[model samples]
Target: MVQVKLFDCEHEQDLEEEINRFLSDLEHKQVVDIKYNIAALREAEDEQIYCFSAMVMYIK
Candidate 1:
């Protein structure tokens, strides 16, 4: 199994799109049983700042 995480302040849609792109690339490389999640979002130290986190997994 493999795991990956992505963090950004952008919207979930954008993040999901990026993650999908990544998964597509991995699929092209013959990776299988992949899973992913947008686990959390929270405010950063700065009030105007935001944080996003995602997790990805796959089985070799």
Candidate 2:
């Protein structure tokens, strides 16, 4: 399994788009499974700054 973490995603749509892009890029590979999680956005110390995390898993 390969894990990819995406941070600072703007919204659900962005996350979905990124996932689709990744999957498309790996279309020719022997991927057995794929999963992802988007973490809630939180303040990043700087005012008006927020961030989120997405975790993706790929299995072969």
Candidate 3:
């Protein structure tokens, strides 16, 4: 069977760390693919926000 896990955070490091921690608890060979995405938005003239996300696909 195939399973999907999603991770999201405002900081890239946080997102990376979360994903790493999750994958570490699983067998490496079971991981099939990892897709990463990012989005940027302007909340004001002088401020910007960033969103980092990842999708992990694996065999369970």
Candidate 4:
């Protein structure tokens, strides 16, 4: 069956690390694709918050 896993982080590197770790623990054949997205939101006049996320599509 097809399944999806979501991973989110404030930093891109951290998100990559987490996804890599999880991918390494699973068989490569199980993973179909990965979608990555980034967005920035204004928290204040001079502050911004960044969101890094990934969607892992795999076969369960």
Off by over 4 Å in 4: none
Q: Which stretches of candidate 3 lie over 4 Å from their true place?
A: none
Quality of model 2 by C-alpha lDDT: 0.56
Error of 2 at 31 (Å): 4.0
Per-prediction TM-score: 0.44, 0.45, 0.93, 0.92
The model with the greatest lDDT is 3
Residue 55 in candidate 2 has what lDDT? 54
Clashing pairs in 4: none
Ranking by lDDT: 3, 4, 2, 1
TM-score of predicted structure 3: 0.93
Q: Which candidate gets the maximum TM-score versus the true structure?
A: 3
Indicate the residue-level lDDT of 10 in model 4. Answer: 99
What is the Å distance of residue 14 in model 1 from its true position?
A: 0.9
Task: Return model 4's CA RMSD, one decimal.
Answer: 0.9
User: CA lDDT of each candidate?
Assistant: 0.55, 0.56, 0.96, 0.94
- The C-alpha stretches of model 1 lying farther than 4 A from their native spots are 1-3, 28-51
